[model samples]
Target: LTIKTKMLVYKACVLRRANLPSVTALLKQKRLRWLGHLSRLEDGRIPKDMLHGELSEGIRTIGRPKLRYKDTLKAFGIDPDQWETLAGDQNRWRQYLHQGIKVHDRNWLQRLQEKRVCGKQAAPESPNHDTYACNHGHGSCKSRIGLFSHMRHCKP
Candidate 1:
């Protein structure tokens, strides 16, 4: 994708994250130079909804059988039953998945919901201690709250 397209995609990603409405108009404003190309493509293009529906139907009817999650977990030397016993919460199970634990091959949101219900998973963990600790152990951090406090103090 061109830089302009990449930026548009990034904006769309941000909107999706925030559950906001389409910003295609904003994209058009920034990328008016590419309007010619967009007009040409739109002349005979397949509708996105139709394309998505076709792909979805194709996937739903794919041939050949697949192993279930239980089987997959067993093949990986993990016991779903035993894991369930120790899970104690759905959130923990989701965290286990997020932590790269081999499990019953379930979808993430389902696992997250399960973990949430069981109180097993806590809030997402920090990937490292770097966010909290400085290289020199000065006790100053660059986290969101820290930056807010810094701005408050530094503002005239």
Candidate 2:
């Protein structure tokens, strides 16, 4: 089993046991927890604010858009439109996670991990790149995860 760190660790994530709180639950809970924390702080400059549509002032590339934490949530059947406000009610957040856990599966785990990785960079450009290695923006990931299958399973 992995150390089970919360989201926003800026590092690769892992999930082992299938019969536990799904990785999706862990991540959603973490994000919602942080959302509540940030809302309590009442700071608009935080990065989380940008996620909540607080500010929109940048132009992004049109093609091959980078996957975001929001996209990862959508992959799990979550509509993050009200995610920021939803976090305020801890019980509601827990209820959402409880509902999410009921349906979380291996496909959700694999794709979420893939989105987390893709958030750091463009997809593998080098065909010769280590397909089985996790170039999870840490130069390398010690988890020894294979991105080839993720590559096949998840498309940008």
Candidate 3:
């Protein structure tokens, strides 16, 4: 399907029906699994250190900080502070992860439905005519030929 296809439609009609996860869900699942593994690792391991490390002294840019992997855990309803404890038990972590994924997926689907409804209500109806409007603030035209002619010498 084209990029113009609505995500709610695509996920409901294709991904959910096919029992396939969206790329985002898959990535989050994998990241959480990897985090569980890292949490179980022995101390001082490079990957685990990187996951938990913070720079002691660095010049900060004057804006919001960049999002880290642990920050995303909140989206799955996992507290970043408690994730290590939760991931300590292999079987329990696996079960929790699955439940979290389900919760996240449900929330995501609900948000998409809300957005679709809101967008429909907010969007203005397009005029039914063979008119073309320039995206660069130029005037519109009644036909493709007129639009093309206007565009040839058009300036933003």
Highest lDDT against the true fold, candidate: 3
**lDDT (Cα, tens digit) per residue for candidate 2, span 39-110:** 555567756466567434878778998867576556545676876576677787667656755445545656
lDDT of 3 at 88: 97
Give the winner by TM-score: 1 or 3: 3
Worst 10 residues of 3 by lDDT: 1-10
RMSD of each: 22.8, 16.8, 8.0
CA deviation > 4 Å runs, candidate 3: 1-9, 59-65, 122-156
RMSD of 3: 8.0
Question: What TM-score do all the candidates reach, one by one?
Answer: 0.20, 0.39, 0.66
Where does candidate 1 clash, by residue pair?
89-118, 89-120, 90-114, 90-115, 91-115, 91-116, 91-121, 92-120, 92-121
Q: Which digits, one per residue and each the tens of the lDDT, describe model 3 over residues 29-134?
A: 8889998999999999999899778899989899999866676687678888888899999998888777778777878888988987897795686554445886
> Model 2, 7: alpha-carbon shift in Å?
32
- Worst lDDT 10-window in candidate 1: 28-37
1 against 3, candidate with superior lDDT: 3
**Cα lDDT for residue 111, candidate 3:** 91
